[model samples]
Target: MSNLVLFTELRQRLDDHLDLVSRVAAEGDAESALSMIRREVPGLVAAVHALVDEHLPDDNGSCRKCRSGPFWRRIPAPCRMLIQVHLAVGAAKATTRDRTRWSPSRHRLQESSVD
Candidate 1:
């Protein structure tokens, strides 16, 4: 298979795994939820750390990973990737705290079919 296909499949699998984890978090028994969390949370944290580590600034405070290919240039530390991770993690934390909290028109979200 092509690299793009492989990458897409990998993305789908990760999404499915996360979805399963979400379901377990919301609907599983206490014992099952605890067991799943114990088994999964560390691995997920490690993976996130690995991604962050790749984007960390080098000695000159430049993002080495992001500077490559046609646009070969050393972007500054706390590059777009790091910024995105920060915003996404923050939003995710807020989402977890209140899953039902959603503003449609104000947030510019389309009305959900369920709503």
Candidate 2:
């Protein structure tokens, strides 16, 4: 399959998995949620690390993967990808600190934390 197709399929599959986990967390046992976390979290962390590594600045302090403009203008260090990560993490932290309800915002919290 083309990369676009593969990426779409993978994103859909992950979305479906998240949906399943949400259902499990809401209706199933805690043990099942904990088990799923144990099984999938390490791989998820590794994937995030791989993306971070790919986007990291080169020796000249330009993003390795992201560029724009006719001359391919360099995006400086801490490119959009890393900045989004920072924003997501900040949102997640703020959300967690302010959260009192779990039933309504489960997926939002998870998405922010893992974005």
Candidate 3:
């Protein structure tokens, strides 16, 4: 399949997974929601990797293509948002040693510290 088509399908799947997560949360099934999110992460990362490898250019030292206009703009918004969110989450995870540091109480502490 073409990269665009694959990206569109992956975005749809990610949307569906997000809906499932919402439903699970509403049903008070935190464990199941977390499990579903964990399962989806690898697929999301793989999709992002595939798209990057396909469309992005490998320069000698600089990323000139990424800074250029309209290439990334051709991608759908949902796919872009998913990629951004995945990167943000990955960065957040990397900054902390314990994943459990993302708990509600810790979040509140972090928020307060920012202010």
Best by lDDT: 1
Q: Residue pairs in steric clash, candidate 1? A: none
Which lDDT tens digits does candidate 1 get at residues 1-115?
A: 9999999999999999998996897689999999999999999899989999899787877787886644446688889878777766654455333443334234422333442
lDDT of 2 by residue, 35-61 (tens): 877887688779789989999887878
The CA lDDT of each predicted structure is 0.74, 0.70, 0.54
Q: How high is each candidate's TM-score?
A: 0.73, 0.65, 0.34
Rank order (by TM-score, best first): 1, 2, 3
Q: Which digits, one per residue and each the tens of the lDDT, describe model 3 over residues 1-115?
A: 9999999999999789766764674465678868866776678679767766544433432233344455554443333434554555654454333322233323321322321
Q: For each candidate, how many residue pairs have backbone atoms clashing (under 3 Å)?
A: 0, 0, 0
TM-score of 3: 0.34
Scored against the true structure, residue 68 in model 1 reaches a CA lDDT of 62
Q: Which ten residues in a row are the worst by lDDT in model 3? A: 106-115
Off by over 4 Å in 1: 69-73, 95-115
Q: How accurate is candidate 3 locally (lDDT)?
A: 0.54
